[model samples]
Target: MKSISSADKLEDQKFNALRLRQLTETNPSIRAEFGESGDNVAMLIDAISRADALSKSQHIWYIDMIEKRYDDLAENEIDDIDTSDKDLKRLHDDLRENLIATITSVSIHSDNIKKSIAETPDAVQLLVNAMHYRGREELRTTAVVAIRTLCSLDSNKILFAKAEKIFKYLTRMFDFRDGLVLKAAFGTILSLWSFLDDTESNSVFTIEPSVKAHVIKGIIKLIEARCFLDDVLEFLARLSIHDDATEKMVMYDATTCLFYVLRKNPSLHTKENCAVILHAICCKKDHRTLIEMRSEEKSRRTLSRLVEGGTPRAIIKVNGILERLKE
Candidate 1:
């Protein structure tokens, strides 16, 4: 007998969840048994949890279905008849959940659906709304995933970055302890950071102090947890390109995380990136001494270890930082 791999199990889960979602949305028997809103929220949450198992084609099909469901809800206007506050909230929440669920499964190059989502003014707002409510980490994770995917395109990045509240929402999303959410949040920031250019009047990266501190805190926590080190380190490296971000990294004790990562025998690419980031910090006019002191507690013990065991490229980068610090 063949063992079911995790991937296979996940696919099975997604299939079952999708079928259940279909049933709740269409079949009256199951719909009546669970009532209207309960089944939809449960099934939508399940679908979102298993969304990664879906293939690209499945994403497209599911996205279309989700959109149709969203449209049906809007067209029905359940709130019109059910004027109760609780009922209205439920209806509004369902509508938001539908949009979040749709965008959650949406990935890059998802064709018209991605384009439609980017073009829809309410789409970004709905994502932020889904993230803003407390105790909705899963929904927030899904929304950040959507943002991460959307930011991969320069046009979409520009569109989303223009949303005045998005920067703050993204910064707050880092407060979620979930690894997936943090990864997606960092990915979105990195994408938007890359998209920033002085040439465009509308393009900007707002660095709210508290928000920036929270983001840095989130990055450090992710590093400490050893979650998504490659992506996290890469994000730090890119963020270091800005002097303010570099200074903040030092203020937030990023050198300690970088040294810990280097000592852990990470992948060669990660080591190289770590070296580059440390080098960047060392080159900073204001924070170089602080980073150097932190990194050289035992007289360059960290850099020496990398030079001894790291790849040739890593060694060169590390040596370059050392040489620069001497100057």
Candidate 2:
């Protein structure tokens, strides 16, 4: 018999990696054998690591494996690895890093993967911890993406609203200089703000008074750039659900921001959100006339465009706000 060469061993590992991906996809029983709740988590991590260096197809399979692992872990009771156990901790970190990478990658199943992470009690906290202390931009970006994805669901939004520490960490990320990082942070904040509509005491989205002013300032600063214009508008629009938030948007010259964005031909969503913010600003007794006279023509024109070209929901919102303006 011929002796097996190192190349042969490497090929075998890659082949095994591909088969593992296939089996995991086709057979949940086999998949559970390598789940995060089982003893095979280390083996899964090892396979993922080896798969990453293989062909593009294998790398994608690795991402799928990571996503499935996250889903499986989400269904089981969470148990943190002992930090004192160096080997276990290393494996934990590796698994988490791979998870972040997979979350950031392109995939049609991203929403399902995100929901899985959101379902996991410790998963959001783990990502937050990594973002707060990891110092790596890529990891931080991934964490923000993961958080944003979680916020996409109403159930997850309520859950996140109760996670004060996660929101606090996300607020701090707004101060980061990286543009991509800033955008991701903004998206996460917007998601958190969506929780504001919840009336339940546990569902209230809280921004401590101490950080409120800082957050307002950070948002306005980000709005100065054209790239973040729509994001800022949408954030303010959602934020306007509270009168105080509307006041802050006006104080930050949001009218001016809206005027420019509308003129530049923003998307229907942006236009609709801008109308909401404007409507909210106009609803305030003190600020109403001032904003009305300041940009009356521009606002009307923007509303017309939205009415003509917006989505059914956007059309309804803008039309109602317009009637209110007319009154």
Most accurate candidate by TM-score: 1
Candidate 1 residue lDDT tens string, 1-327: 011123255434434444444554565566444333333434443343333223223435545755675556664464543344344334333433443544444333244445555665455555555566553355567677767876776667867776666766777776677767777887787677556644234635555555556666667777877878888887777677777777777777788778878767788889888988887777774455554545574664778778887778778878887676555
Best by lDDT: 1
lDDT of 2 by residue, 49-99 (tens): 333333234435545755666556643332331222333333334434444
218 Cα displacement, candidate 1 (Å): 3.5
- Cα RMSD (Å) per model? 14.2, 14.0
**Residue 274 displacement (Å), model 1:** 1.5
TM-score of 1: 0.61
Error of 1 at 213 (Å): 5.8
Q: How accurate locally is residue 28 in candidate 1, as Cα lDDT from 0 to 100?
A: 52
Which stretches of candidate 2 lie above 4 Å from their native place?
A: 1-33, 36-123, 149-155, 171-184, 199-222, 228-232, 263-272, 282-327
lDDT of each: 0.61, 0.57
Worst 10 residues of 2 by lDDT: 1-10
